[model samples]
Target: MAWVVAGVVCVLYFAGTARPGYLLVRDFVTVPDPVLGAAALGRDGAAPRAVPLDAITAVLDPVVPAALQQRLLLVGSVLLLGAGVGMLVRSRGWPAVVTATVVATWNPYVVERLLLGQAPTLLGVAALPWLVIACRPGPYRSQLARALLAALPAALTPFGSVLAVATLALVTTATSGARRAAAVALPSLILCVPWVVPALAGAPTRSAAQGADAFAARQDSGLGLVGSVLTWGGIWAPGAHLSSRAEVVPMLAALALVLVVAASAILAVRGGGRRAAALVLAWSVPPVLVLALATPVGLSVMEVLQQVPGLALFRDTHRLLGVSVVGGAVLAGLLVARTTRSLSPPAVTAAVALIVSVVVTTVPDGPRRLHAAYTPVAFPSEWADAVSSVPAESRHVLVLPWQAIRPPLPGGRVPFLDPVPRALEPPTVTSRDLVVRRADGPVLVPEGEPEIRLDDPTQARRALDSRQIDVVWWWGVPESEPPPGFVTVHDGSQITVWRRGGDPRSQLPRGILRPSTD
Candidate 1:
């Protein structure tokens, strides 16, 4: 029966895989800076500042489409979820409860993230509960196989690696004589050794520096740290005020339920059980404390701490959703065991209600569309296609400001320069400008902030000459006036491409025009 339920869930996930492109367009469109950075690293050893836009373009690159990979990821997540359910059904007591908790924690919201190619954090969160279940001192003799199974997911991604280590350390400390925990943790340690090679081979990239800065920035504000926790925990709704009376009711009810179950569990299992409870508290404490110290008062303590340096290593605080659910499951299971022993029908009914309530509250709404705040930036299909239409031999194509390219070009070999806010570099640019002055390639002049400064023809010409830029893609033009010395070749509702001078190709190098088909 348990396997049947797991099978149904897996099928639902698999059935949803057919429209990976549409899914990417709808829900996973927001090209985060980190994802952009990762893509750039995958393309070229160094990432680019102007690569965020280019990365999106690269994902759509005709040569290397991400559709198949996305589908496989969806399939894998479904299988993982089924595996989690199977583990729960086969286990007993706290271990069974832990497995169930992991299933609940791998919620639709988290699954949605996974479906969208953001596997690092999801992988990390998934590893923790799995490790706990695998390392629990039990009668299982397949120690080697269990250890490998526990470590494999964690070792696959950066986020998972951190979470695997943290869980291993915490579980070992909490579980007396759980010496085999070290064996389970060995795989992750072994897997992470290679990242060091990259650090050794080149000068440190801004990733480390930026990561540090991002962490420190959170520490300094404390608001983000707090808000991050609340948001991550799924406790704070997008538009609702935390202090409102409406919010207080749900918060209080959830808290009351959690406390009641926890107390009941402790009372049912005195002695060793009490010790186990203490260990649970201890295991849960550090993350909470780190969150509290990192976040300010009035913030959702759990969410904010997720952004801290050490904590930030684990991207999703909602992963703790597994912890909460697992804790509740353990409490419920213990309560059931105790109540059944006493043969109290009324108590049993109440316990069933409590279990149902926990499940109801925790099952987050299934994956939804990307937030409005991120929609425009998320869907870049039209823009990517437009950019790809540029003739390959054309060296200098000016990209207009409004048409922001996303997912920088694959391999970071192609150069894309946007002229936006001078203070801000494009999210995907390498330390050096490889394409800016290339004799054979066309320089891309991104329209907008910096180009707005080009309102003065002399200044614009000087700006153009300085960067060796020849062509301009102008967007959002009025009929009355347009920039001087440029002939409009293409004009649309919000964009216009311009060729500067009759001999626009004079400065462009031969064979430089290779339109990006991604």
Candidate 2:
């Protein structure tokens, strides 16, 4: 039953991926073979957002094809997520299981995150239901062990790791005492060492100056910030969510569902499963707290929190709403179970089917929207050729048109984070600052990634002389020619590779500062 629900959701959401091509959308970039460089280890001077996820991919490149691994991870994450939700409510009966599975997988949060290409983070989120079950009251040692084991998947990304610890702390405390919660929390936190160590060791002095506002949850629908989040639809990225979410009608339907689930959760506490229902309700607090922090006064509070090392990672508060999905699904399952007790089996089946259909079609043409948006793309041949053109001695490869997010590739509409750093052998340097386009104007997220400054010719020359950046892979047409010290080695229609010449002290040409065509 869980597999069926998962399959339906996956087919609806990612059917286009069945065709041969890479799932390159937004920040979701996959390479055939990722380079196991300093950046992958989070030793790069930038933030550790990719962290151990990149390192894990590089390590698995030998045993599994990167593309296949990615497909498996993405699809499998959804499957496991549905299955875990199903397992949580299986004791309630098949109807409960089905309701929980559908509600968990077929929601705005999952859809938005999938479209945004956050497979790793989603994978971590998939473990939440299982973590809840594992933390159930039992022998302290056995419960602690199962809880830690369940948390391993969420530890894949830094955000996921934090979420895992939070979930464990809450659930373990609910079932056991605070002392047991501490026991579980300490070990679960230790699991984050892969990212935490690298982040603390080499993270930049200045994190993103404007990231709090840039990544804060925005009102996607007619519902303002709080209302939008209640419906699980407020994402920072405009295009990342289902287009239907912008409509007042669908958002209203979603809000009604939220109210129904809340009422059902209260009934669940009074009827039975009080602890479970309360815990589910408790899960809503984190997201609400996050939304509170997103407010103007809350952002002022966040400013102080950002001063603490590594706290900046949670700037994107919407992602923290993931646990809310689990809560909503389980509570919805309880609603289905408690309401349908006296109904005939055939009527129950019909009722469940109608509910499922309504839940799916609420966002009209969702599957088609995903299919059209998720077209697979093959990497351009020039990209590989450009990397191969660089000399073996070049230690650092810098991608030009220094946008943190690359402009759309040929035949593609979605722009993604530059894949050059992962594709190349050398440690690659690119802009960490994200440029977000808004109706008003362009907002620059000054995320500090220490790189050669194009504005300061002397600084750029010094970086070249010191071999901090030995090769430049410029994509698209530059406003001006390469400065005297950069000799073009391979110039293709789209990609041009430049290596440092013997004379590194030459002055940079004025034309080098012009805005990139990208």
Best by TM-score: 2
Which window of 10 residues has the lowest lDDT sum in candidate 2? 509-518
lDDT of 2 by residue, 80-101 (tens): 8999989988899989999889
The sequence of per-residue lDDT tens digits that candidate 1 reaches over residues 1-518 is 33454455545434544433322321122222112333233232332222232344344445444444434444454445445534543444333333344344333334434433344344445455566666666543564456457766555454455556766655654663445566555544764443433323333222231222222212111224442332223221121112221243334443454454556556744646544674346325433644644344413443344333233333233344434433444444444444545546676556555654544343232222212111222223334433333333343444433233223332221112232111112221112211111123333322112211333335444645554444454434434333454555655554455555554222221221222211
Over 4 Å off, model 1? 1-20, 25-65, 71-89, 93-103, 106-120, 133-146, 169-184, 193-249, 264-269, 273-279, 296-334, 337-354, 362-518
**Clash-forming residue pairs, model 2:** none
Q: Which ranges of candidate 2 are over 4 A from the true structure?
A: 138-145, 202-205, 272-274, 391-393, 439-441, 449-462, 465-467, 477-481, 509-518
Using lDDT, give the best candidate's number. Answer: 2
